[model samples]
Target: MPYITGERKQGLLLPSSIEDYINPSDPVRAYDAFVDQVDITELGIQTEPNRVGAPEFDPRAMLKLLVYGYSYGVRSSRKLERATHHNLSFIWLTGGLQPDHKTIARFRRDNQAALSNILKACAHVCLKLGLVEGNTLFVDGTKVHANASMKNTWTEKRCLESLKDIDSRIARILSECEQADASEQGNPSLVKMRECLGKQGKLKEKIQGVLKDLQAGQKNATNTTDPESVRLRSNGRLGVGYNCQSVVDDKHGLIVHSDVVQASCDSNQFSLQIEKAQQALGKPCATACADAGYASTEDLKKSLDEGMDVIVPSARQVKDPSSRVKKEHFAYDAKDDCYRCPQGHLLRYIGDHKQTKSRIYAVGDPEQCRQCPLFRRCTNSDQGRRVERLFLEDVRERIEQRYLQADAQAVYRRRKLRVEHPFGHLKQNLGIRSFLLRGLAGVKAEAALAATAFNLVRITTILGPEAFVQRLAA
Candidate 1:
């Protein structure tokens, strides 16, 4: 068999054009066209037709380069700068202009607000293209690693210990400096000791600041590298990262709203996400679905009050291992406002627990439970069994009832598919396991750019380059 061969130094007779490098059907062209049509001026990008001083690269070109680079999973600014020189797609997108990595990094960092607006712009485009229905939204959150390292994170106790160690080291160094100065004049050892002391002083200052924040109850743990980043449980392990929440429209998998939060859990974030999604869509979503993590009584009530049909599974109650009779086995008598146990015992309402906002109901007579034949299987406590119902127990029961319906169950089943798909693609394909930028603001910008890139790719996939270009033009 003959091996395929090519000329080592092939020369072109005619000068090759950058346009000739990529086909018109290439997605980069669509990306370029999309950027060209979108009003990035609202994103704080300059759009002057001409400049007087030293020539500046068009903001549109930079936007195109960044968006196109993110879509193809090239997130590092340095890598993108290199791509501008080597990659034909990047060359075509930037029109042969290669901005340095600092410029690229600055563009993303300084335009954090604008980057978020760009994400909204992309969502608006999706809506305009009739790709997003904005009727049903799926809310979910995933932990994305922050730029900080887990090793850099410190709890209050750890911070105090570290500060003590630094103080001891400084004391030892000061003692050494005193000895060096007394032993010899103009000794290098003295100079080295002073330098070490200065370095330690700065570190000590930083640690003390962190300690102050901890003492003030501003944060639970502090990351020296990224203060806004928090220690969160991710992928079954503790890591320094942010919890990224996203709301996806059911019409397409496009993310309508996204936010980066320090909260480790999603229970309190339900209402905020719904409000953001509704604001972004400029209309209310008829239904919302989330996993059990987002199910909280306050959030559930808020969702219902907002007129959205929420489909979130309630938290599973802890079953007593020794007893077979679960809370569900108890039957409530609405007429008498009491619960009847499986053994035919009435648990009358005693009073309300104000702290827990639950009404307590316990068996009126404990001696009757002591004499019952199923006492061991029913109540292990000497006070007999007790039941607590929340003030909003009726609302919870109504939500539970709705969750069991065929329609609600069907909608809930699509939650994982709609929500996880974007995260999976972002992590597995785009390599967004950890954020390139530091701080919450930077990470939020990075996330917005990533989401915008994902939406662009989806748009291009659904409507090929030509049609996508037409849509942008439209």
Candidate 2:
């Protein structure tokens, strides 16, 4: 068949297609819609809600935008504002209008405490949903960035130097003012110089105040922050960062409890985190696991006191080879509070309160130490041979007792599978590298948000979309 010429076969002109897809369904809208169902504002965020003021923006709306934005990795406030105007999802979520960057930034900064409370509220909701199964809780600490800096910080000596610099600058400003006065005929520069001198005086006052505070804190503090924060190095580098501690449930990898601390090491982190986790669940933890870093005699005893079966490696001792061989080679006597020498001479206790307070116990008679052939091997002190037993010796004994237990090993093996898996998911999939906020308070809030985000993912994974929607609605 040959090709036919075109003919007007169309009857009445069909109506133009009416559906023009101007705005597609937005994920931010979907997320915000989910948040809108929650009654977080009803929980009373602002302490004084009735103060007469200009028409205030809804805290809930701001909260919804922030949580949704952070969940999707849109962290910058300025960027979020732009997205509200341009992105369909953000536009839908923000109700076709964009809040200014100052408003968004103020929401985050002014409401830090309120935002923190909201996190706790979210955890309570999770508990209400029966999402937390506290069969095992793994505790660990990670370093996060702080607001202070290595450069801004000053050590004891550096602080004095800073004060001197401020004083010298103030003196120079005063000298300039004096020189200006000598040549002044209502000189404009003289007025400026006086103002400059006034500002310099204020700067000197602030520097002096900081110096006084630093000295006071250094002299009084049982634990001190080097340069404004304690001198603790992480990842083989010295920087100011907080150690964020978390105790996560193993069953669902949900964080049961979390805290922020200024401590540089994990030595004292165990008991506090474990106890908090236990308290949150309202039950005693049957078993707990930690790395060698948290292993300490005091913590082991505290864990025992809490009725928690702890699994940790033994603490290392700092001694030269000779002392190591001498004491370790011989057997320790608990009842006698002494050690038996290899030659079978009983090492007796000699009272020395000063050494004892330092956790060193004086043992063996001075005469005995003076006479023994092995004196050269053991005794380097002018006093006598001493054996320093840890105050909580039984704690170490208990740790050794648990180290041999099969259940301890089983729990420890579960630790990597439990806590690290969630941490890996958060860092890799959720994009939590460093905190968006700074300082202890800000970092704590960020940690809470990260935990909440992780839990949201987990809740979605476990409950599926439909069930999670129902749970959130409920």
Candidate 3:
């Protein structure tokens, strides 16, 4: 049998493999092509120095490999390194070379400052691409895992008991060491005693350190590799995780301002996120939407003061009974400037003032409620029902007015579509159920990288690489 050759010509192309049709193009190759154009040495790369004092691989190339690896759910540096050998896209991207896992891990661990700068670069790209426009912005937070376990949380009592046990163990070890020193064959056992004593001493030092921490009012005793990470509650359950906040653009669901927080509640987060959105976009957005988590009187006041529009629902719980009362139930007395309840009793202002800015109209007619059948349904308090109104009742009134408006409802309906996609993709599709990094700073860097990767994915889907690169350059 004769072996047939495709071509007798020099520099001929090899035949395509069956695997070539599995994927139309190598995704890793596309990523590498994107990363090669940017020089990250000026920005600083995080990977370790080359082995045997050899020149390091291109930082941008390594970054492209890491990100593209992560995009396809390859999180472990070791796994990513393995993928480079066999994965065709990865092979093409890395030029058929594999950077070790340690190098990959060190790049992320060491280059905190550079990673932050890179995140900003991606954000700039989004801004230039018009993904982040200063219009409607959605604010929300999600929880990510901390480095510590829920079991490590030590209470004041637990700390005391744990320290006590350490002290007792140290005392026993010291006593044994002294006994060994006095024995007939002391020298041989002396080394063992000394070793035991040294270990005990180290334990004592650890105990003292913890005791001092408790004395200094350190409520959290989490001793993890990342010390800055705090325990935050998510879904009403306590866990060690970071609270990541994002202000997403309503236009393309791209995150504009992203931050990681240790704060458990969204109350204090609103003002900061709004401020970030303003800074990120270089202008306060025309309209900002947040749920009741960001709804506080002070936050609303601050947003309005900054010349930005806000759409936060009334906290519902803070509303006055006066608003709940039917209009027909209130009888106005023109002469005395008083109002009467439906029970035919005059309502007068009590000497006490309600803290809200609105006027307080109290109907303290003890006899009126005593005779009315609705008293039980109205007030459980013996002092009778007190109606306190806000000083700027009109502010809340206006908010309610907007809530009732058709346009506002429509905008609210758009909220889920605008903001939830990124988070859903991040948590479900991306497999980032919990954070692998710990501490506030580390987690912040991690969150930013995640958001950057997410934006890149979106930009890739919306416009091909050609358009995206042009936008980034522009």
Best candidate according to lDDT: 1
- Cα lDDT tens digits, model 2, 390-426, are 5666667678677767877787777777777656766
Q: Report per-prediction Cα RMSD to one decimal.
A: 3.2, 7.4, 6.9
lDDT of each: 0.86, 0.66, 0.69
Q: Ten-residue segment with the worst summed lDDT in candidate 2?
A: 17-26
Q: Which runs in model 3 stand beyond 4 Å of their true positions?
A: 1-30, 33-53, 165-201, 217-225, 317-397, 465-474
Summarize candidate 3's per-residue lDDT along 1-474 as a digit string, tens digits.
999778656695543653442343334434554566555765576455655787876676677776676666676779888987777677666665688889887877776556655555665556766776768888888887776787766555766787788788878877877777677455777787678778867766775676677568656555434456566776688877777888888888887778888666777677778788777677768888877677666557677777766777776733556634443367656578566877766777654454544455666666666567877765655666655555555465566666667887787778778777778888889887676666665667677777767777887778776666555555
Query: For model 1, how does the per-residue alpha-carbon lDDT over 16-61 read when each residue is reduced to its tens digit?
Result: 7888888879988888887887788887676667757787678889
Show how many residue pairs clash in every candidate, following the order shown: 0, 5, 8
In model 1, the clashing pairs are: none
- The ten-residue window of minimal lDDT in model 3 covers 21-30
Question: Residue 82 CA error for candidate 1 (Å)?
Answer: 0.9
Answer with 1 or 2, whichever has the higher lDDT.
Answer: 1
* Order by lDDT, highest first: 1, 3, 2
Q: What residue runs in model 1 are displaced by over 4 Å at the alpha carbon?
A: 13-16, 46-52, 171-198, 317-325, 333-340, 344-356, 361-386
C-alpha lDDT of residue 254 in model 3:
82
- Decide which is better by lDDT, 2 or 3: 3
